[model samples]
Structures are given as C-alpha cells and as structure tokens.
Target chain A: MAAFIQLFVSGLATGAIYALVAVGFMLLWQTSQTINFAQGEFVMIPAFFVLWAIKILGVGFWPAVGIAVIASLLILGLLFKRAIVDPMLKHGVLPLVISTIALSIFLKEAVKDFYSSQAQPFQAMIPSEDLNLFGAVISSQSIFILLIASGAVLGLNKLLNGTRLGRAMQATAQNPSVARILGIPVERMIMYTFLINALLVALASLMISPIYLAKFTNGDTLGLAAFIAAIVGGFNQVRGAIVGGLILGVIENLAAAYISAQYRGAIPLILLIVVILWRPQGLMGRAEERTV
Target chain B: MMDFLTSRAFKGRVFVLLMVGLIVLPFFLRPFGLLLVAMWMVHAVAALGLNLTLGYAGQISMAQGAFVGIGAYCTGLMTLAGVPYPIAFLCSGALCFAIGWILGYPALRVQHHYLAFVTLAFSTLVFLVMRNEEWLTNGIYGLTDIPRPILFGWNTGKAQDFYFFTLLMTSMLAFCVWWIIRSPWGRAFIALRENPVRALSLGVDTRRYTLMAFAMGSSIGGFAGALYAPLVQFFEPNSFSLTLSLKLLLMVIVGGSGTFFGPFIGAATEVLLPEWLRIAQGYYLIIYAMLVMVLMMFCPTGIIGLGERIISHLRQKKISSERSAQAQAMGQDKVAQTKSDTQGGAGQ
Candidate 1:
C-alpha cells in the first residue's frame, strides 16, 4: 500500500510536468491549428539555457532561471512566430507540421553538436528531503514540482479565463475571421499564445530537468508523453490535459511497479491508441461539429 | 515544344534512358557503390509506399520505418527458421498489410496531426517492442548473418548480382505502382485525398479506399524492408527509428509528393546527397534539416512540382505569345483593307 502511494505521488509530480507541456500544446492547437512537433524540444532548450547561465555565465539559480525564461520568450516565442510560424501560416497545417518536425531535428542535433551530447545534471530548486504522509514517503523536490506546476497552471487559467487578453485569445481560437471582424488582432493573439506556450514549456523544462535530466534526446520521450497525455485527457480542454497528465503519470508509475519495468514506456502509447480509438473527442473535449 | 515535353514519347524516352542507366551504371562502380545504389532502391521502394498514402490518399503516416522494421524482422526470422525466401518475403508483406489495415482504424477516427500522432505512437511502440522483446529480436544485439537468397541457380551473394536483383524488383514494384495510379482505385484515392466528404457523396467508398491505401502502402513498405534485410545483411532496431521515418518522408516531399517519379528522385537525393555532404561531417544533418524546412516553406510541392510549375508556365507563355502574334497580323490586315476601302470611296 505504501509502495503504491509512493508511486502514485511521484506519478502525479511527473504528470504535473506533462500537464504543463500539454496545456502549451493545446493552446497552439486551439488558437492557430498549429501543432508544434518541436514542443518537447521547446521544453528541452530552456533547461539548457538555464544550465548555460548558471554553469557558464556564473549566475545564481534564480537569475539563471530568469535568463532562461526571458530567452525563451524572445527567441522561442517571438522569433519562432516571425521565422517559422508566420510564413508557414498561409501554406496550411501540413507544411507547418513538416517544418516543426524539421525544427525538432534541427534543435536536437544543434544541441548535440553545439552543446554537450551527454546528459547534464540540473540543480533542483529545493534540496531533497524525505517527508512521510500516510505511510508514503515523498521527496521535497517532488512536492516542489507539484506545487510550482499547479501554481503555474492556475495562474495561466486566471490569465485565460479572467483577463481581456485571455478572452480575446479565446475568441480568436473559436473563429479567427469573426474575431478579427470584432476588432481583435487575430495574428497578435496567435503570437501571444505562442508566447504563453513558450513560457509554459520553459516552466516545464525547469521542473523536469532535475528529475529527467537535461539531454538532447530528452525531448523525444517527453514530447511523446505530453502528446499522449493531452490526447488522453482531452485535446481540447485545459482541465482535461491536467487530468490526463495526472492519470498518465500514476498509471505509468503503477505499470512500471506492477508490470514489466522494461515496457513501462509502452503504457502511455497503448493508452493513447485506446483513447483515440474509443473517445476521439477525449474525456474533457467536446465532439466537434463538422461543416461542409 | 510544350506538347512534346508532355508527350508519351518524351516520357518513354526518359524511362528507357533511366533503365539503361540502371542496367549499365553498376559495371563502372565498385562493390561499395553497388551496395549504396541497392540501399537507395530499398529506400525508394519505401518512399514510393509513403507517397501512395500521404500523396495520393492524403493520409499522413510516420510509421513507415516501423513497417520496414517489421518486414525486415519477419523475413529475417522466417528465413533463419528455414522458410523459403520467397515465402518469407510474401509473409512479411502480408503481415504489414494486415497490421496497416488495423492501423487505418485510427485514421478513420482522426485526421491530419491527430492521425500523425497516432502513427507516431505506433512507431514508438513498435520500436519499444523491437528493442525490449530480447527473446525475439535479440534485444539490440540484433539478428546477424542472414543469408542472401538464391534465385533459380543465380547466386545473389555478390554485391553486383544483388544490385541487379534489386533493380529488377524495383522496376516491377514501380510498374505495379504505375498501374495502380492509372487504375480506378487510383482515381478513388485521389478523390479521397481532395475531399473525403465529397468523395463519400460521389459514391466512392472512402472507408474501404482509405483502408486499401494504407494496406497497399504498408505492404509495399514491407516489401522494401524485406529487400533491405538482404541488402544490408545486418541492422539493429535503431535503423528503424522515427529518424528513418522522417528521412523517408523527406524523400517523398523533396522529390514531389504526388508525382510518380518523385520518390526515385527524392530517394536519390536523400541517399546520395548525404554521402556527398559527408565533407561537412557532423553538420550534414543540420544542413539537411534546414534545407527541408526551407523546401517546405517555399516549395511545398517539392522538386518535381517545381519542374512541373516551370514547364506549365513556359507552355502558357508560348500559347499566349502565339495568340498575340496572330492578333497583330490580323489587325494589320484589317487596317489595310479599311485603307483600301476608303481609297476606293474617294476614287468613286
């Protein structure tokens, strides 16, 4: 029972990170119909930036994180819009999809070539300390990860649901032409979503790096996991992503414990297939009305 | 000129020239070069399969490499177990066809990126199984020394002999693809691609055709993999990763997605260009990735599409210019007639 609880808690912690990444994915899909295949790389690149700042530039941890976030906002968020997204927007989804896949390869190989191919240990925000609750032990780092991830999600929820910018972004997502006719800057709103996505992925990167390790290939697994989580939870709903991520985390951990550890990675993929087959709209998403 | 360019004669001549090149080129190259060409043929076959699915039917798949892996393992294991090479090859293709038919179920439920993700998941799953199921796949140590086949007393253990065998197989496969593309099923696939809903309204069985597109495409991929096993003689699970899938995709896109000759050109560019670019060492892939991104951004139709565009443009220009020149001559004749009439009126 204790072991189960331990696995569940750790699962939730990782699930939180997956949720953050999924929400970012969902935002881009919702707004621009742009599925960023490089999303895992988005999470990956920022952690390296933070690592660069602290190790190479001799900055403090908080300041290093700040540098990483700012860099992501500028380069990944803004420059990404200008260079990759804006030109490809007119072409349709497939071109963008291909470009993002190319971007992912570029990012991965760039890191491997320019940065170290070896996995780098990242400094966790909180030092490790074991705490017991209900006969289950959890680390302070896991607890920190959970708190920060949820807090970020809540903050994003407030931004989207409460703010005018959020409503405008939502309006743009529903119908870009209609939103533009109503005087909302549709393109700008899309850019904002990209910015928001960059920020979310950056947070996820920082949170996950310590546990997952900062490596070039880290994006491959994390990216797929986030995709599965988002699809399983519900591709259309933010809340669904959260629930899906938590469920996936727990399920994967449990499977690793109870089932064969070697095939643990296969669990989410199998889950993705099942969910896609059974509930195409996802658990939290509504069935889209098809129009001719 | 435009008519000749698009004529049957021009295409037939091009085909003969290519055939001659294939038949004669290996005589000049060393064993390694022969092997490279054979590898290209294998990849070209796979890319052709992808082109049918993504280009003709407009169903995107990122699992072609996985199908290839399945084909390789199936053929390798079967032949190792004393099964005839021909039966193992057929079995591998059959296996992929059934698996691909099942994979098409997810496609029926989702479209575009969702479908891409489903296939991506599948590819990853297959990779995991291939890597982890050590008892069967040898768990990364990989099955080795798989013997080459003997065809009617023709020993294909030699690289040059194998190249000829692959060339013959590729030409046959290409002919099959050509026939399929010209058939009613091909028309149905094109319809399915242009608009599934409209195709359904037009009495085309979109579901069955969709499944057929996937099955045929995957079976072709399996055939390519079966060939790949004999050509390489040794390969690990890593050879069939998402990277291979993407590389095959690059070939289809770069060569021209919908065009018949696109896969061949794309495969050549993919296989040979990298070899040439080995001068850049580690930077070759980075260069390759950038080139693909640029290609997608500027010329999504690929190299074949670009050529088609230029040809059509010139044809239109020729037609328009001819029309204008004839108009100019007619206008002059009309003016002279009017002048003569006015002169006759004055004389009267």
Candidate 2:
C-alpha cells in the first residue's frame, strides 16, 4: 500500500506535466485547426534554452527560467508565423502536417548538433529531500510540480472564462470567418494561441526536466504521451485533457509497476488504439457534426 | 499540360527512356552505387504502395514500415525453414494483405487525424512486438544469413546479379501498380479522395475501396521488405522503424504524391541525395529536415511538381508570344488597309 501511494503520487507529478503539454495541444488544435506535430520539440528545445541560460550565462534557476521562457516565446512565435502559419494557411492541412514533422526533425537535429546530445541534469525547483506522509514517501519536487501545474491550469481556466481576449480566441476557434467578420482579429488571436502553446510546453519541459533529465528525445516520448492523454480525454476539451493526463499517468505508472517493464512503452499506444477503436469521439468529447 | 503527360506517344517515350536508363545505369555506377540503386528500387516499391493509400485514397498511414518488417520476417523465417524463396515472398505479401485488411476495420470508424494516430500506434506496437518476441524475431539480434534467390539456375549471390534480380522484381511491381491506378478501381480510389460522400452516393463503395487500397498497399510494402531482406542479408528489428516509415512518406510527398512517376523520383532522391550530401558531415540531416520544410512550404508538389511548374510556365509563355505575334499581324493588316483606302481615294 505504501508502494502504491508512492507510485500514485509520482504518477500524479508526471501526469501534471503531461496535462500541461496536452493543454498546449488542445489549445493549438482548437484555435488553428491544425495540430503541431513539432509540439514535442517545443517541449524539448526550451529545456536546452534554460540549460544554456544556466550554464553559459551563469544565471540563477528562476532567472534562467525567465530568460528561457521569454526567448522561446519570441523565437517560437516568429517561427510559428514564418514556418507554419504562413505556409499552412496557403497549402492547407496535409502539407502543414508534413512541414510540422519536418520541423520536429529539424528541432531534434539542431539540438543534437548544437547542444549536447547527451542527457543534461537540471536542478529541481525545491529541495531534493523526500517528504514522508502517512507511510508514503514523496519528493519535494513532486509537490512543487503538482502545485504549480494545478495553479497554472486554474489560472488558464479563469483567463479563458473571464477575459475578453480569451473569448475572442474562442470565437475565432469556433468560426474564424465569423470572428473575422465581427472584427475579432482572428489571425492575431491564432498567433497568440501559438505563443501561449509554446510557453505552456516550455513550462512543462522546465517542470519535468529535473526528473527526466534534459534529452533531445525526451520531447518525443513525453509529447507522444501527452498526445495520448489529450485524445483519451478529448481533443477539443481543456478539462478533458487535464483529466486524461492524470488518468493516463496513473494507469501507465501502475502498469509499469505491476506488469512487465519491457512493454511499458507500448502501454499508451495500446490504450490509444483501444480508445480510438471503441470511442472515436473520446471519453469526454462531444459528438461533432459536419456538412459535406 | 496534363494531356501531354497522359498522351500515348509521350508515355511510350517515357517508357523507352526509363528502360534505357535502367539498362545503362548499372554500367556507370560502382557496386556500392548499384547496391544503393537496388535498395532505392525496394523503397520505390514501398512508396508505390503508400501512394495507393495516401496519394489515391487520401488515407494517411504510418504503418508501411511495419508492414515491410512483417514481410521481411515472414519471408526470412520461411526460407530459413527450407521453403523456396518465391513461395516465401508470396506468403509474406499475402500475410500483409490480410493484416492490412483487418486494420481497415478500425479505419472505418475514425476521422483523419485519429486514423493517423491509430496507424502510428499500430506501427509502434508492431515494432515493440518484433523487438520483444525473441523466439521468432531473434529479439533485436535480428535474423541473419537469409538465403538469396536462385532464379531458373542463375545465381544471385553477387551484388550485380542480385541488383538485376531486384530491378526486375521492382519493375514488375511498378508496372502492376501503374496498371492498377489506371483501372476502374483506381478511379474509385480517386473519387474517394476527392469526396467520399459523393463517391458513396455514386455507388463507389468507399469502405471496400479503402480496404482494397489498404490491402494492396500493404502487400506491396511486404513485397518490398521481402526483397529487402535477402538483398541486404541482415536486418535488425529497428530497420523497419518509424523513421523509415516517415522517410517513405517523405519520398511520396517530395516526389509528388498522386502522380505516376512521383514515388520513383522521390525514392531515388531519398536514397541517392544523402550519399551525395555526405560532405555536410554531421549537419546533413539538419539540412535535409530544413529542405523538406522549405519544399513543403514552396514546392508542395515536390520534385515532380517543380518539373510540371517549369513545363507549364514555358507553355504559357509560348502561348502568350504567339498571341502577341497574331495581334501584331492584325495591326499591320489594319494599317495597310487604311493606306490602300487613302491611295485609292487619292487616285479617284
């Protein structure tokens, strides 16, 4: 039972990061009508940015995090405009999808060549000591991650529900033509969605990198896991993504603990297949209608 | 422009040129180059299979690599078990066809992105199974010493001999694919791509056609893998990975999806360009990735589209020049007629 609690808590911590990434995907897909296949790269590259800030500039952790987030937002926003938004708007979805995949490859290769291909250690935000609670041991870092992740989600929910810009973004997402006709600045809103997505993924990377270590390939794994979370919860729903991430994280952790570890990597994919087959609308997603 | 490409004489010329190129290509290249060309042909076959699904039917899949892997292992194990090479190859293709057909069942339920993920998941699962299943796949140590074919007393042990044999097989499959795409079923696939609802209304049977496309495409992938296994003589489980699958898809897109010669051109570029760009050292893949992104951005049609664009642009220029020449002649005629009228009036 103690082992179970430890596993469950660790899963929640991991799930929090996945939830962040999943939310990024959900927001991007909703606003842009295209998913960023390079999202994993976004999760990965920011850690390297933070690493550079810390190692090269000799900055403190909070300062490095700030610099990394700012740089990533600007660079990714510009790249989103040039590499994705422009061409994607012109060519449509398939080409955009292909380009995103290319972007992913480019990001991976760039990090491998420019940054160290080897895994780099990152410092945890909190103390490295473990906390004992009711026969279960948890790290201070895990608690920190859970708290910050939840806070971010709550903040995001409030912003989306209460703000004018957030409502405009939602309007654009629902119907871009209508939003544009209503003078909602649909393009700018979409761009802001991209910016927010980049920031979210970078934040996720920063939060989890201490435990996972900053590796070029970490994004691919975590990004894929997050994607599964979004799909399982509901691609179009924010709360669904949050719930999905936690559920997936707990299930995957339990599976790794109880089942054979050799097949752990296959667990999410298997779940994805089952979910897709059984419920295409997803567990929490609405049944959408479209005219031909 | 489309008409010119589809014209009988033009197609015949293309056929003759390709045949000549194939016959002459082996002479100029070294053994290593020949080997690469053989490998290119194998990939080209797989790309053609991908074309059937993605290019024609408009269903995106990332499982071609896994299908190929299954084909390779099935043939490898069969040959190792003392079965003849030809029978083994056929059996591998048949198995993939069955598996692909089954995969189409799930495909019927999902939308586009969902389908992509399903295929991706299926491929990952296949990869995991192949890696973990020690008894059958040799568990990442991989199958080795797979026997090459001895077709009608000709030994295919040498690189050149194997190249010719593989080339023959690739050409046969290529021709079959070409034929299939021009058939009524191919038209249905195209209809399915353009508008599935309309296709269904017109009694195109989108589901059956999609299933057929999946089955045929997967079988071709398997065939390519079967050919690949013996030619290389060794393949680790990772050889048929997501990267390879993405590369195949890249070839199709880069070469010009939905076009007849796109897969061949794409396959050639993918196989050969890396070798030529080896001077870039460690930065080659980064450059390649950038190139793909730029290509998708500006030249979504790939290399084949680039050629078409040039040809079409030239044709338009020629047509405009001819139009201007005719206008010039008409203007000159008007001037002459007016002068003649004035002269006649003066004479009167």
Candidate 3:
C-alpha cells in the first residue's frame, strides 16, 4: 500500500507535467491544424534559459523564469510560428510537419551549440522538505509541481471558458473565415495561441527542470510522451489531455515498480498502439469527419 | 535545347552517364571514399523504402530506422548461428515485412498526424526492445566480428569488391522500385496518397494496397539494414536511434520525395554533405538544420522537383516567345493589307 501510494503521487506529478505539454499541443493543433513538433523544444529551450540566468547571469529564480518566459514567447512562439509553420502550412500537412520537425532539430542543435550539451542542474523555486502523506513521503518539489501544473490547467480552463479573449480564440479555431467575417482578428488569435503555448511550456519546464536536469534530449522524450498523451486522451480536447496524461503517468510508474524495469519505457507505446487501434477518436474525443 | 533535354533520348543518355559514373567512381576515390559510396547505396535502399510510404503513399513513417535495425540484428544473429548470409538476409526482410504488416492495422485506423505519432511510438518501442534484450542482442555491448558477405564464392571483404556488390544490389533494388512505381499497384498507392476517399470509391483496395506498400517499404528497409551489417561489420542500438530515422526522412525530403532518382540524391546528401560541412565542427548540424528549413521553404519539391520546375519554366518561356514572334508576323501582314486598301481608296 505504501509503495502504491508513493508511486501514485509521483505519477500524478509527472502526469501534470505531461498534461501541461499535451495542453500546449492541443492549443496549437486546435488553432492551426498543425502539430508543433517543436513543442517539446519550447520546454527544453526555456529550461536551459532559466539555467543560464541563474548560473551564468546570477539572477534570482523568479526573475530567471520571467526572462525565460519572455524569450520563449518571442523566439519560439512568435518567430518560429511565423517563420516556419505559417509558410509551411500553405504547402500541405506533410510539409508543415516536416518543417516543424526541422524546427525541432534547429532548436535542439542551437541549444547544444550555444549552451552546454551536457545536462545542467536547475534549482526548483519551492522548498526542499519532505512531507509524509498516507504512508507516501512526498517531496516539496513534487507537491509544488503538482499544485502549479494543476493550477495552470485550471487557469487555462478559466481563460477558455470565462474570458472574451478565450472565446475569440475558440471562435477563430472553429472557423477562421467566419470568425474573420464576425470581426474577430483570427491571425492575432492564432498568434496568441502560440504565445500561450510557449508560456505554458515554459511554466511546465520550470516546474520539472529541478527534478530532471535541463538537457537537450528532455524535449524529445517528454515531447514524444506528451504527444502520445494528447493522442490517447483526445487530440481535440483539453480535459482529455489531462486525463490521458495522468493515466499514462500512473501506468508508467506502476509498470516500472511491478514489471521489469527494462520494459517500463514500452508502456506508453503499447498504450498508444492499443488506444489508436481500439479507439482512433481517443478516450474522450468527439468523432470528426473531415470533408473534401 | 529544353525540349531535347526533356526528351526520352535524353533520359537514356543520362542513364548511360550514370552507369559510366558508377563504373569509374571507385578508381577516382580512395578506400574511405569508396566506403562512403557504399554506405550511400545502403542508405539509398532505406530512403527508397521511406519514399514508398512517405512520398508515394503519402503515409508518414518515422520508424524506418528501427525497422532497419531489426533487419540488421536478425541477419547478424542468424549469420552468427551458422546461417548463410543470403538466407539470413531474406529472413531479416521477411521478419520486418511481418512487423510492418502488423503495424499497418493501426496505420489504417489513423490519419496523417496520428499515423506519424504511432510510428514514432513504435520506433521508440523497437529501440527499447533492442536495448533490453541482452540475451538475444548482446544489448549495448553490440554485435561484432560478423563475417563479410560472400557472393558466388567470392569474398567481398575488400573495399572495392564490397562497393561493387552494394552497387549491384542498390541498382537491382532501384530497378525494382522503378518497376513498382510504373506498375498498376504503384498507381494504386499514389491514388491512395492523392485521395483516399475517392480512391476507395473508385474500387481501389485502399487497406490492402496500403498494407502492401508498408510491408514492401519495410522489407526494403530490412534489405538495406542487411547490406549495412556486412559493410560496417559492427553496430549497436545507437546506430538505429530515432535520430537515424529522422535522417532517413531528411534524405527523402532533401533529394525530392517520389521522384525516381530522389532517394539516391537524398542518400548521397546524407552520406556526403556532412563531410563537406565538417569544418564547422559543432555547428554543422545547426547549419544542416537551417539548410533543410530553407530548402523546404523555397523548394519543397526537393532537388528533382527543382529540376523539373526549371525545365518546365524554360519550355514555357520558349513557347511564349515563339507565339509572340508569330503574332508579330500576323500584325505586319494586316498592316500591309490595310496600307493597300488605303492606297486604293485614295486612287478612287
């Protein structure tokens, strides 16, 4: 029971991070109809930025995060989205995807060249004490990560549900042409979606960087897992990303503990194949039929 | 000039030029260069497979590297277990063909981006399996000392001999690809890519043809991997990482997807471009990434597409100029007739 609880709590924390990444994917996919393969790079690059600020520039944590978020919004959200994805969108789905993959390669390689290719330590903003809850010893960082991740989700939900800007974004996603006719600035809304995705990924990166070192390859693994999470949950739904992420995280933890550690990595792939085969619409996704 | 260049006779001339280039290429380069050429052929085999799925079928598959790795390991292990190299190679292709066929089931259910992620997940799983199965694979320690291939009782252990052998295989495979692309089944694959719903409505077996393309593509991947083993003599999980798969995709795109010689051009770029850009040291990949982005932006059709565009542009230009000249002559004739009519009226 103790082992189970411990695994569950830790899994929840990891899932929250995965959920954050999945939410980023959902936002971009919803707005642009293109998957930002560089979404993982958004997290990784910002995590490195925070590392640079604190270690090289000798800044405080919050200030470092502030700088990273701004930089990510500018470089990843605006510049990358405008330059790479927007133009590639005109070509076709495959070209758009290939361009994003190219963008990811650029981000990863740029980080490796500019920053240290090796993993760098990053300090979490939260305190480092351990708390015992129902036989599970939870780290302060894990608690903080869970709170912050869930908070971001709730915050995003509120923005999407309760705000004019959120509604405008949704309207744009529903039909850009109609939204344009209705006087909603569809292009700006799409830009805002990219910015929000950047901010959310930066937040997630800051939350998880202390647990795992800021490494170039983190985005590849995390991005892949988050993509799977979004797909298994439902590519079109935000709540599905959260639910799917939690399920994936818990399953991964349980599989690692009970099953052979070697096969732990295969869990998500197995789930993905099963989910895609059994339910292509995903766990909570509405069936959408694309017309010619 | 453009018309002559695009003529069927021009194609034969180009083919003969390529044949001459292939025959004389070994003598012009050192052993290392010869080895690079051999590796290029191996990668071309894999790129051809990718082209079938990504280019011809319009299906996304980032798992080509993993499939290649599976084929390599299977052949390597079988040869170690005393199987003949040729039979082992065939077995490897068959195994990957089966895996690809099974993967096709889920592939049929998903659309473009979904299919991409599925292949990504499948590749990750293949990597995990390759890394974990120490008993069968020797795991991270990797397989070493695999004997070189023997063809017709001649040991292709020498660099030059191996190069020729790989070249022969690449040509045969390339020919097979060309035949397939020209066949009815290939047309069905392209039809699936162009319009799945319409193709299905038109009596094409979308599911079966897709599965066939995926399986055939994967078998080619396996064949490439099998040939790859004898060339390198040792490999590990690192050689078949997702990065390698991405590189294969890069080759296909960079060389121009779907074109007959596109995979070869892509394979050559993958094998040789790095050496040319090696002076940049740490910045080579960054430069390469930027190049790919710029290339995709400006020329999404790859190298072959660029050539086609140039030829077509030239043809259009020539035709438009000739039409203008003819119009000028007609205008002069009308002016002459009008001058005669005006003169006659003045005389009256």
Candidate 4:
C-alpha cells in the first residue's frame, strides 16, 4: 500500500511538471497553430541559466529563478519575433513546419554548446525534508512542484476567463481574422502566447531540476514526454494537458515498477498513441467537427 | 544540325551523357572509402522513403527512424534464423510496409503537427521494443556478429564490395522513383500532395493514396536498414534513435525535399562531411547544423534544383538570342525584297 501510494505521488509530481509546460505548449499551439518541438529545451535551458546565474552572478535560488524566467521570456520574444512569427506569418504550412524544426535543432544544439554537456545536479530551492502523508513519503520539492503546477493551471484558467488579454488571446485562437477585424492585435497576441509558453517552460525547469538532473540529453526525453502529454491531453485543450500528464505519469510509474525500468519510458508513449487514435478530441479537449 | 538540335532525341542524348558522367565520376577520389559510401546509400534510402510521404503525399512523418529500425531488426532476425540474404531483405521491407499501412489509417485523420507527434511517439515505441525485447533484440547488447550477404559465392564482406552493392541498390531505387514519377499514379501522388482537398474533388481517394505513400516510404526505409545491417554487422538501439530520424529530416530539407538527386547528394554531404570533420567531434554536430542552415538559406532548391534552374536559364538565353538573330535576318530579307520590288517596277 505504501509503495503504491508513494509511486502514485511521485508520478503525479512529475506529471504536474509536464502538465505545466504542456499548458504553455497548448497556449502557444492554440494561438499560433505552431507547436514548438523545442519546448523541452526551453524547459531545460532555464535550469542551466539558473545555474549560471547562481555560479557566475552570485544570485540566490529564488532570485535566480526569477532571472531565468525573465531572461527566458525575453529570448522567446526575440526568437518568436525574428525566426518564427515574422517569417512564418503568411508562409505555407510546410515552411512553418520546417522552420520550427530548424529552430528546435538550433536551440537544442545551442544549449549543448553553452552548458556542460554532461549531467549535473541543479541547486535545490528547498532543503531535504520528507513529509509523511498517508504512509507515503513526499519530498518538499515534489509538493512544491505540485502546488506550482496546480497554481499555474488555475491561474491560467482565471486569466482565460476573466482577463482582457486572455480574452483577446482566446479570440485570436478561435478566429484570428474576425479578431483582427474587431480591432484586436492578433499578431501581438500570438507573440505574447509564445512569451507565456516561455514563462511556463521556465517554471517547469525550476520545478523538475530538483529531481531530474539537468543534462544536455534531458531535452530529448523531457521533450518526448511533454509531447505525449500534449497529445494524450489533446493538442488544443488546456485542461486536457493536465489530465493527460497525470495519466501519462501514472502509466509510466507503474510500468517502471512492474516492467523493466528502461522499457518504462515507452509505456506513456504507447498509451499516448492509443489515446490519440481512440479519441482524437482527447480526454477533456473540445471535439473538432469532422468535415466528412 | 538544327533539326537534330530541336528534336527530343537530343534530350535523351544529354540524359545519357549525364548518367555516363556520374558513373565515371567516383574513380576521381582516393580513400574512395566504401564504408562511408554504404552509409550514404543507407541515408539516401531513408531520405527517399521520407520523400514518398513528405515530398509526394504532402504528409509530414517522423517515423522514418522507426521504420528503419523495423527493417534492421527484421533483417537481423532473419539472418539469425539462417535465412538467405535476398529473402531477409524482402521480408524486412515487407514487415515495415505492413506497419506503415497499419499506422497510416489512424494517422491520416490528423493534421500536420499532430501527425508528426504521433509518429514521434511511434518511434519512441519502436526504440523501446528494440531495447527491451531481449529475446528478439538481445536487449542493450544488440545483435552482433550478423553475417555478410553473399552473392554468386563472392563475399560482399569487403568494404568496397558493400559500397558497390549499396550503390547498385540505390540506383535501382532511383530507377523505381523515376518510373513512379513519370507514371500517372505518380502524378496522382503529387497532385494529392499539392492539394488534397482539390484532389479529392477529382474523385481521388486521398486516404488510400496517403496509405500507399506510407507503405512505399516504409518499404524504402526497410530496404535501407536491411542493407545497413549487413554493412555494419553490428546493431544497436542508438543506431536507429530519434536523432537518426531528425538527421533524415535535415537531409531531406537540406537536400531540397522534393527533388531526386537531392537525397543522393544530400546523403553524401551529410554522412561524408561529418566523417571528414571527425577531428571536430566536439563541435561536429553544431557545424553540421550551421552547414544545413547555410544550405537551406542559399540553396533552398538543392543542388539538383539549382542545376536544373541553371540549365533552364541557359536554354532560355539560347532561344532568345536565336529569336533575335532570326529577326535580324528577316529584316535583311525585307530590305532585299523592297530593293527587288523597286527593280521590277523600274523594269516595268
């Protein structure tokens, strides 16, 4: 009983991190119709930045997190404005696909060049404290990561429902042309969507770095998992990302425990494939009307 | 001479000349390395498979690596089972084609990125299967000591012999592609890629075609992997990872996605260039990326496309000059006619 509960909690914590970044992915994808394949790199690059900030700039953890998030958003602004947003505006779908892939490669390789290519433990935000809840061991970092992930999701929901900018973003995603005609700056909304994605990805980095050591190849695995979360959650749905992440997390954990640890990585991925095929709309995602 | 120059026969002559030139060009370089040549052939086959879906059917796929693995593993198993080389190759390709067909149906319903993601997941699934199925793939140890393919009692275990064999296989596939492109069905495939909705309006079943494209592409991927297995004689999970898939995509894009010789030259450049710069292994991939970007920027049409453009431009210029010279000659004739008319009038 204790083992199951512990595994479940760990899974949820990891899933929560994926969901957080996946939320950002959903937002960017919904608005721009562009999925950043390098999103995991974005999640990973910030931890490296945080390390740099602490080691070189003499900043503490909290301030380093803030600096990493801000700097990451700024880079997102530049990358979106330059390589992505401007060039891909009216280009055909193929160019958009190809260019983003190119950008992904660029960012991933750039991270490797900038950081120490080997894996390393990141600076922890909290001390090593295990909390006993229902006979399961929960770490301070896991709880913290869960809280942040949940808080971000709720915050995003509120922003989408109540705020003017979020309303405009929703409007752009639904119908960009109509939004544009109604005097909404749809292009800015799209660019800001990227900004939000970067912010969320940075937050994910801050969350996961405590457990999963920051490494160059971390992007590939993290990116793959996040993509699965996005898929199982439904590509366009915000809430589905969280649900999808949890599902993926649980499946992966169970597989790791019950099956070979190496093969465990393949579990969530398989489940993701099955889900997408069975429910193209995803668990909580809106149903896309079939054109027949 | 003018008549001959204007005839279609001249075009055939040019094509033969080009083919002959290519055939004789390889002897010019030393190292003339066969292992690298075989690698290029494997990559070329992968790129061609990608082209079937991406270039022809207008679908984006990230499953090239998975399909290649399918082929490699299948080939490995068959060789282990004491199967003949030709039978193993055929079965490898067939297995991949079946998988492609199965996946194509569900995948066809999704749009661009979604489809790409599904294939990504599938590739991950493949890697897992390859790495985990200890009985089949021998787990992480990989299937080593696979025997070299024998042809006419001549062991192709020699590096140069494998190179020639791979090159021959690539040529056969290229010939197949040429035939497909010139066929009506090929036109239908391109039409579907260019505009699926419009193609559907013309009674073309886009789903069936897309499935066909996937199958064809997977078979090519399998063929490449089957050849790849015998060349290296060792198989590992990393050999067919997501990076390989991404590299194939880079090859397609950098080589100009929709062209024929693009894959040929692109594969050579992508494979051999890294081999040549082995000293810079530290920054080798970074250099490879920058090179791809440069290629994408300046030579978006690829080497073949650029060459085609240059050839067309020269032809156009030649035609324009001929037209001008003809006009000048006509003007001279008109002048002479006027003078002759005057003379006739005076005689009258």
What are the lDDT scores of the predictions, listed in order? 0.90, 0.87, 0.87, 0.79
Best by lDDT: 1
Give the alpha carbon lDDT tens digit for every residue of B33-142 in model 2. Answer: 98998988999999999989899988889899999999999999998889989999999999999999988887778767888888888888899899999988998899
lDDT of 3 by residue, B6-54 (tens): 8989988999898889889999999999888889889999999989988
Write model 3 residue lDDT over A184-237, tens digit each, in one string: 999999999899888888888888887888899888878887888998999888
lDDT of 3 at B17: 97
* Weakest ten-residue segment in model 3 chain A by summed lDDT: A92-101
lDDT score, candidate 2, position A82: 59
Docking verdict class for candidate 4: acceptable
Window of ten residues with lowest summed lDDT in model 2 chain A: A76-85
lDDT of 4 at B24: 55
How would you encode candidate 1's per-residue C-alpha lDDT over A1-292 as one tens digit per residue?
A: 9988889899999999999999999989998888888999999999999988888999999999999999999989999888988888888998788888889989999999998999999988778899998989988888998999989989999988999998998899989999999999998999999999999999899889998889999998888878888889898888999989889999999999999798999988899888888987888888887665
Clashing residue pairs found in predicted model 2? none
Order the candidates by TM-score, highest first. Answer: 2, 3, 1, 4
Per-model TM-score (chain A alone)? 0.97, 0.96, 0.96, 0.93
TM-score of every model?
0.95, 0.96, 0.96, 0.89
lDDT of 4 at A49: 83
DockQ of 3: 0.72
Task: List the candidate 4 regions with Cα displacement exceeding 4 Å.
Answer: A58-63, A290-292, B1-32, B277-281, B291-348
* C-alpha lDDT (0 to 100) for residue A64 of candidate 1: 94
Better of 3 and 4 by TM-score: 3
